[model samples]
Target: MSEHAAVDQEASNARRGRGASGGAAARRAARSGGGPGTQLTYIKRKINVYEVLDEEGLALIE
Candidate 1:
């Protein structure tokens, strides 16, 4: 192979190694529940709608 081809191949291999390691690290982070930003704050636990709004109140709204 040409010198340029060899250099390109080496760079590509290096990038692949880094990418594999990065993917593993990401998986580990995910398995650990991720960072604070990955929290499920947007998700609310199951709640009984009837408890918050009675049938009469719902009927009024409707």
Candidate 2:
């Protein structure tokens, strides 16, 4: 039981750290004049293929 509890705590801490790191990294990415989420760039290049593709696949569309 103690071993299991320790393992659980470790896992939780790891998850929290990972989440925090990811958020920080995302913020950094958004801050360096680059962001679809950071309210900095008007044009976010991270749009996926489907969003970039047009209905017919010929004309460029937003």
TM-score of each: 0.28, 0.29
Local accuracy of candidate 2 as per-residue lDDT tens digits, 1-62: 99999999999988786564457668788678564454454765775564655577655443
lDDT of 1 at 30: 78
lDDT of 1 by residue, 9-53 (tens): 989998776565567678799788776665456777797665778
Against the correct fold, how does model 2 do in TM-score?
0.29
Q: RMSD for all candidates, in order, please.
A: 10.3, 17.8
User: Which stretch of 10 consecutive residues in model 1 shows the poorest summed lDDT?
Assistant: 33-42
Quantify all predictions' global Cα lDDT against the true fold: 0.79, 0.70
**lDDT accuracy of residue 17 in candidate 1:** 62
Point out where model 1 deviates above 4 Å. Answer: 18-62
